[model samples]
Target: MPKRVDHEDRRRQIAAAVRRIAADRGLEGVSLNEVAAEAGISKGFVQHYFASRDDMLRFAATTLRGGIEERIATPLRVRDLLVALLPLDDAGRDDALVANAFLVRALKDPEIAGHFRTGHGLLRDAVAALIAAAQADGDLAQSVDPAAEAGLLLALVAGLGDAVLLGYQTGDEAIALIDLHLSRIAA
Candidate 1:
């Protein structure tokens, strides 16, 4: 019998390869040939999984977002949830690099922009919900607007990631900035 091919797993593998490339060389390094080589698969196999580079990038971006969502899915303190979004470790750094690449491309590609915008919206909404929960739990200042605070939090996280990527700040420093923000807002 022919070997059973798990399509989802194979797709994830290919996406992972793209992410590795993105981490090492930014968005410019993500090509079918590069991904195939990184994945130890044929270029044809990579093409079989993704019709084009953009498709592969979209898949990779979605995968990165899914990983973040999974991590924050469980109930946690709002501070912890925000910390989980930072690029404090290798995996998080890689995710941030890939995400940053896509975000830069989004400036030129409307479709890519839409995908990122949607993802950011989802994150913002989730953060807003968490803020509301924290307020209800008396852990955060009830006078703060959850939606506005969520937007600020998202902006700060994104800015911090950029700062870290650009060497303007270390990962630890970025996390500290976030921690400081949380402390100032604590009830």
Candidate 2:
């Protein structure tokens, strides 16, 4: 009998390799040869999964986005949810690095840009739902607009991650800023 291949699992393995490479060497470092080596697969196998670098990048971005959503899915307060979005620890730092690499590349690639834009929309919607839940639970000011606040919060978190990556701020400092923002909106 032939060995059954878990295509999704293999894809995730490849994407993990992509993330590691992007985190270590930025988007420019990602290539079929490198990802294959990192994944312990052949370059032909990598090509079998992704037709081009852009396709690999799109998959990697989707993988990263799915991870963030999964992490924040647990029941948590609005403040905690906001904090969860920060690149405060090792895993968070890696995710942020990969995200930044993708963002930069997205600026030059329309397909990648569309993928990110769609992911951001989904993230914003999720955040807005969390904000609405907080308001309903009396944990946040009822006057706040969930959709608008969600957009602002996402922007703030993204900016803070950039700052952390650029050495302009520490993760602790970024968390402190987020805490302050949360305090201001408290019910």
Candidate 3:
């Protein structure tokens, strides 16, 4: 009998290797051999899943977006979702590193930039919906624009994540700042 290959699992393994490389070295001059070594697989194996470096990166970006969407899909409160975006743990830090690395590349690559724009837009829309719900429930002020508030919240969280990554502010301090902002917006 032939061995059954889990294609999705193999793809995710390759993406994880890419994330590790991006986090460690900023994704510049990364080769198939390097990725294969990091993934503990052969270069041919990586090629079997991805025909080119750009394809691999696209897969990694999609995987990253999927992760964020999954977290958002969970039945968590608005505060919990905001907290989850912070680099409060090793996994979050790794994610932040990979995301920042890709962000630079996205500025130059239109395809990559599209992926990021779509992901960010979806996340922002979801947050806006949540804010609208809060306003309906009288938790947030009626005068606040849900779309505008969601955009500011997302930008603030992104800035806070960068601060945490740069060691300028601790994760707890960022979270406290977020809570302070939320309190000011409460109805």
- What is the Å distance of residue 37 in model 1 from its true position? 0.6
- Badly placed stretches (over 4 Å) of model 3 are none
Clash totals for all models, in order?
Answer: 0, 0, 0
- Cα lDDT tens digits, model 1, 89-124, are 787787888887778888988877887888889888
Candidate 1 worst ten-residue window by lDDT = 62-71
lDDT of 3 by residue, 20-50 (tens): 8987888884679899999999999999999
Model 2 per-residue lDDT tens digits across residues 34-116: 99999999999999999998888888877877667766888466667777888777888888888888888889888778888
Clashing pairs in 3: none
User: What lDDT does each candidate get?
Assistant: 0.84, 0.87, 0.87
TM-score ranking from best candidate downward: 3, 2, 1
Model 3, global lDDT: 0.87
What local lDDT does model 1 show for residue 99? 82
Candidate 1 vs 2: which has more TM-score: 2
